[model samples]
Target: MLNRERYRGRLIDHIGLVVRDFAASKAFYTAVFKALNIPIGGSDERNLWADELFISTSDSDEVEGHLTGRIHLAFQAQDRAMVDAFYRAAMAQGGRDNGAPGERSYHPGYYAAFVLDPDGNNIEAVFRGASERSAAAVRIRY
Candidate 1:
């Protein structure tokens, strides 16, 4: 399981991506995430994935009435190398590039790369440069 405490202060709690083609999207995400050392938390009904990014098909009950596949999702990279690897893996998996890896004026250490998934969603791998986080994570004893 992911350490939810690590995501504190983020505006969004979680996000879901409703894709058109399940198989392609799954393969693409799996490959890219593997390059980043993130695991595939879980899967649902062979048509959905319950990971950091909850991927579902348009036929899903919750998204049946909605049109999806248009959004920008950025994944955190441990370093610039990981961002580069993510771009390579994503492209090797048939993804299209939106931007190459580089530093951004968004902030002093903001580096990112962007790609378009098979379903047209913009996916990014970003390295926020060297900086200390406020907390290691929210900890608790179970």
Candidate 2:
């Protein structure tokens, strides 16, 4: 099994996106995050040392030379309610709904919501714990 502390310790400091238009991508991400109530981590126009960068390009430009593809990214949710809220917020911000908040059997009580960012990147908000039923039984909301 994975080391729980190590996994939890390596919190996602940031995420990088490569887009055709930096401004548009930034705007889209900003709006989506705002709606979800996630604070802006950081951004820059002169970031050259980053592994993933969102650079300005033309409409005809392709991601990594391909017309379209997906990059997976996820955010931590405080609880199941926050996951639901994030899903609604993302949809309100022009994100396409990919999945609704629910328990994932694969993860054994993993609750999450998913959406496609403006650049087609897969974004998710996840909460790990028992399902609402079980959680309620134990009075676990946080």
Candidate 3:
């Protein structure tokens, strides 16, 4: 997995996107995810999912209505090198270059890369640089 602990309660546990072409999207994600060291959690004819992201055909009933606009998704990178690898692999697998790998002014050490998926959604891989965390995650138990 891509270190789910950083999200905690700030981001939703999961999100789904309806892509114009499932095959292209699948290829693009698979290549880039390989660079980031995340696995394909599961998939079938209609959709694919990994960790917190879900992708399916635009005609699918659940996501058909939301396929018009682009979406932004950022994946965590363990280091700056992974961000660069993600950009290269993504572009090699039909992803369009949105932003090259570099440090962003979003914060002092926010290094990241961006690309446009087959559906034109903004996909990113980012590393916050070396830092320590008090805890890997904040889990809720009933």
Task: Please list the Cα RMSD from the true structure of every candidate, rounded to 1 decimal place.
Answer: 3.5, 10.0, 4.2
**Best candidate, lDDT:** 3
Report clashes for each candidate as comma-separated counts. 0, 1, 0
Which order, best to worst by TM-score? 3, 1, 2
lDDT of 3 by residue, 1-142 (tens): 2233323454577789887788888889889889999878767766777766878886665456457478899998999999999999999998899999999999999999999999899999999989887775565443
Tell me the tens digit of each residue's lDDT in model 2 across 1-142: 1111111123343344556555656665666566455555345562211112233333423224433358877766668888898788777666788888898776676899888877878888898874343231121122
**Sorted on lDDT, highest at the top, how do the candidates line up?**
3, 1, 2
Model 1: lDDT of residue 15: 77
**Per-residue lDDT of candidate 1, residues 30-86 (tens digit):** 889888777675656544443336777777764453547489988888999999999
- The deviation in Å at residue 47 for candidate 2 is 7.9
Model 1 worst lDDT window (10 residues):
1-10
**lDDT against the true structure, each candidate:** 0.77, 0.58, 0.83
Among residues 3 or more apart in sequence or in different chains, the pairs in candidate 1 whose N, CA or C atoms overlap within 3 Å are none
Worst 10 residues of 3 by lDDT: 1-10
